[model samples]
Target: MQQAINKVELRNLQIEDYKELKNSMVEAYSELKEAYWQEEQIERLLEIFPEGQLVILVDGRVVGSALSLIVDNRKASATHTYEKITGNYTFSTHDPFGDVLYGIDVFIHPDYRGLRLGRRLYDARKEICEKLNLQSIIFAGRIPRYAEHAKEMTPKQYIEKVRAKEIHDPVLSFQLSNDFHVIKVMKNYLEGDVSSQEYAVLLEWNNIYYEKHQQLINTRKSVIRLGLIQWQMRPLNNLEALFEQAEFFIDAVSGYASDFAMFPELFIAPLMADYNHLSEADAIRELARYTDSIRKKFQEFAISYNINIITGSMPLLENGNLYNVGFLCKRDGTSEMYSKIHITPNEVFYWGMKGGSQIKTFDTDCGKIGIMICYDVEFPELSRLLADEGMDILFVPFLTDTQNGYTRVRNCAQARAIENECYVAIAGCVGNLPKVNNMDIQFAQAAVFTPSDFAFPTNGIKAEATPNTEMTLIVDVDVDLLKELHEHGSVRTMKDRRKDLYQIKKLKS
Candidate 1:
C-alpha cells in the first residue's frame, strides 16, 4: 500500500540530504536487490554537477531523488558498459560543453510509491533540460519483469511486446508515457541485475526546443546564404524561352554560392504570354494550368543547382476551386508546398482563389522554417503560431500594385519578426505584367528582416533592394544569432511574453 504526500519540498541535493537519499534508495531497491551508490560516490556527483542533482522531501524527510550528469554526446553515443559511462557511480563523465543530460538514477521511497512523487521528480528533470538547453535526456531503462517472460521470449521480443502494449513492464511503461522513446537494447549494461537479466533498453526524450548544436552556437556564427530574385516581367515567346530564362537566373544565383534562392510572387506571369487575350478570371485559370509543369521545373532547378528554392507562388486549380501555392524544392530532389492562407481582396474577387486553412512549418537540413505568401504575412497570429512550433525563419513571397500595399506587407513583416523574435525574408514582384490584367501594376522591394535586438542589426534590416527594380539580393544570415537573441538579448521578448494574461487560441480542425 502507498500513502499520499501531505506536504513536499523539492530542491537541489545538499550534503545533509545524502543520508536520507541513501536510506530511500535502499528501501526502493530492496525487492530488486540492485547495487546502490555509496555515500562518497554520491557526494562526488554533487560536487561535479550539482545543478543536475535534485532531491524531494515530505515534511522535512527525503522521499525521492533524481540524479543526472551532463556528458559529451560523442562519447555517450558510443557503446559502453554502465560502470564506464557513470565513472564507477561517481559521474566523472560530466562535461560542461556537452549538449545531453544523461540520467544517473531516479527512485521513490517504497512508502511514497503510487503517490506520483516519481512523476514530479521527472518533471523537474524536464525543467532542467529546458533551462540548460540540452539536446535530450538519455538513459537506460530496466525491464523489471523481463525475468518473468525470459523463458518464453527473448529480450528483444519482450521489448517488442512492451512497445505494442501487449505486455507492460513497470520501468519502460512509465518512461514511454513520459515522452521517452526506445533507441535500442543494450547487452551486459548492468552487472548483478537479476530483475532485468543484465539487459537494458536505451531511451531518449529529445528536447525539441533545444538551441542548435555547438558549432551552430559558437561565437563564429554559421550563416545560411539567401539569394532573393526580383524577376523581370517579359512575354515568353515559347515554353523553351521560359526554361531558358529560368535557367539563366539559376546559373547566376548559383554562381554566388547561395544555399537558398527565392523568386518573387507570380514570377510565372511571363509564362502566360500565349493566353494574354483571355479575361482576368480566365487568364488566371489558364495560368493554373501550368501548375504541374512549374512544380516539376522547380524541383529540377533545385536539384541541378544544389540549392533550396522557394518558387514564388502560382495559381492552381484543385477540386474545381483555385489556390495560390508556393513550392519549396530542396536540393535533395524533395519538395513541399504551402498554400496561401489569407487571400487578398484582389485574389478573392478578381483571381477567384480560396484561402487555405492549415499552417505548416518545415524541417530543412539547415533549420526549421516556415512559408507565408503575401497577405498571409500581414497576420501576426499565423507567424506566432509557427514561431511556437520552433520556426527560425519565415519566407514571404508577395505582390503589391501600389506603394501603400508594399508598405503594409513590409511593416507587418517587421512587426512579426519583433513580436515572435524570428527572422523574416520578403521577396516581391517589382515590374510590369502589361499582358496580365489585375497584376499589371507592380510596385515592390526585396528585403530580409531580423529581430529588433542588440544581437541583430540596429535597424532590424539584413538586406534590401531598390523598389520597382528587377534585381536579386543575396545576403548571408546567421541562424545561430537567432538563438542568442531568444536567450540573452537585451530584451528577451519570447521569454518575457505575458502568457497568463492572454493566449492566441487555435481552433480545432
Candidate 2:
C-alpha cells in the first residue's frame, strides 16, 4: 500500500497456479539461453510447499511467481554475515535461490509491462525477509549494454570486447529511475535484451534505494511542549462535575499539539464522605469500578486529541485484589498500564495489599517508554530493569506530599536517566482526599527529566494543572532523538555498556 498504483493482487502461489508461473519463468529464462529451467527443479520447488511460494496475479492469471531458496545452516557455522543474509545459503544459482542471490526474479509477461506488477512482486519478497528475520534484502539484477558494431576477435576476446561496450539505454534508465545502483557488468549472461554476446550490467537495491518505502514513518520533527499533568484534585463526584476542573485544563491546551494533561492519585472517590469507615471489601469493589472507567475515558481523550497523557495512579484490580496503577496511552490506541510495584509502608500497613513485581515497557509509534508507580520508583531495581530492556522514556506516577517532592523524584529520575541514558517523566497527585477517618494527601506537581550526562536545553513542558487546579497535560515526544540514543553514534548509550565484564557478574546470579 505504500506508494501503490496498480490493481495487482498478491498472494501465496498455489500448486495449481505453479504450472503457469513455472512455465512463464522457464520461457523467460529460455530467451537468454539459460539452462535454469527444468522439471526436476520444479519438483524441488514443490517441496517448499506452494503455500509459501508467493505469486503476483493480475486478473485471473499468474503473471509472476517467486521461487525462493531456503538455506538452513543450523548444523553448520550459523553466525556469519553471509549465512545470516541469505537464509540457509544454497549456493545453487539455478532455481529460486539463484533468483534470490540475483535479487527477486520478476518476469512480467511482456504484455503486462505497463501494469507495475514488478514492484508488487518485490513487496512479496520483502515480507519473506521479515518472517525469516533477515537484516537487509539485497537484489542482484542485470543491466544491458550493447556494442555499436561487431569486430573480429577470439572467443575470450569477443566476450571481453562485448563486455567493454557501454551504452546509455532505456532499461538502464528504468533501473536508475527505481534507484538501483550499477555495481558491475558481464558478457552474454543475462535474461532478455540483445545477447549479440552483449554486455550484462549488474545492479542492486540496497539501503539507498529509497523508493517510497520510508515515506509513511511519521518523520515530522517539530519541537512540542509536553506536560506531566498531575492534578491535586480531591475526588470526582458525580463524574461530570468532578471532571470540570480537569476538563478546563484540557480545553486550554486543546488547540495545539502543545498542551498539558494529567490525572492524580484516585481522581475518582466513592461517596466522598468517610472511606475508612467503609469495609475493605466495599472500598475495593468501588475502586475496581472506578479503575475500569478511568482506563476507558483516559483512552478516549488521548486518542481524540492525538496527545501524550500519563494517566496517574488509578486503582487496578487483578483477580479480586486491588492495587494502585499508572498508564500512558498516546493519542493513538496504543496503551500501556503499570501496576504499583513498590508499596508505601503506610499503604501496606493499612490496606493489607501486596505490590507488583515486574516492570513493563511499551513500544509506541513515538518511542520506547516504561511506567513505575508512586513508591516503587524509590527502588533502583525498577528503573534498572526497565533500562536493561532499552527504555527510552520512563514515567513515574506518584502521590506526593505538600513539599511537592519534585527534587526527590527528580533526583531518582535523573539517576535512572543517566544510568540508562533515557528521558524520565514523574507526575504526582496534588490534593488531599479525606474520607471518614484518614486523609490521603497527594503531591500536586510533575517534572520532566533527561539524562544528566547530556545537555537538555530544558525541553518544552506542556500545560500541567496549576498549584490548585486539576488538568490534562499534553506533550509531543521527540521520538527521532530517542531512536538515535538507542543506536550508535557520538552518544550511543548501548554501545557504551561494557557487557563482557558485566555479563560475568550477571551470569553468576
* Per-residue C-alpha lDDT of model 2 across residues 1-509, encoded as one tens digit per residue: 22443456788765677667766676655556552434545554556534335777766677776655533323111222322333423334223322222343456665566666766665666556544433334433333333333355433343344344433443454555453555544444432445334444455443211222334567433243555555655545565665566555555565555532555555554334434567654565565666666667767777777666667776666786768776776777666777787777766665556686556677654455677776666777667667776676777776665563555665676677666766666666566666622345655556666653223434423223455445545555554455445542346555576786663112211
Clashing pairs in 1: none
Candidate 2: what lDDT? 0.55
Please state the error at residue 348 of candidate 2 in Å.
0.7
RMSD of each: 12.7, 15.2
Cα displacement (angstroms), candidate 2, residue 350, comes to 1.4
- Please provide, for model 1 over 1-509, each residue's C-alpha lDDT reduced to its tens digit, 9 standing for 90 to 100: 33454678889998888778888988988865544677888778878888889989988899889999898776666667788889876577889879888887999887877778788888899889878989989888888899899999998899889888999897898998787888888988888778899898888887755767545432322588888888777778766787787778778888898878888788787767667788777888988888888889879999999888998899889898999998999988999988898888878887788988778798777778899998999888899889988898898988888999999999999998888888888988767777767767788898999998777889999989987888888888887688767755778777787999978756744
Q: Candidate 1, 203: how far from true, in Å?
A: 23
TM-score of each: 0.61, 0.51
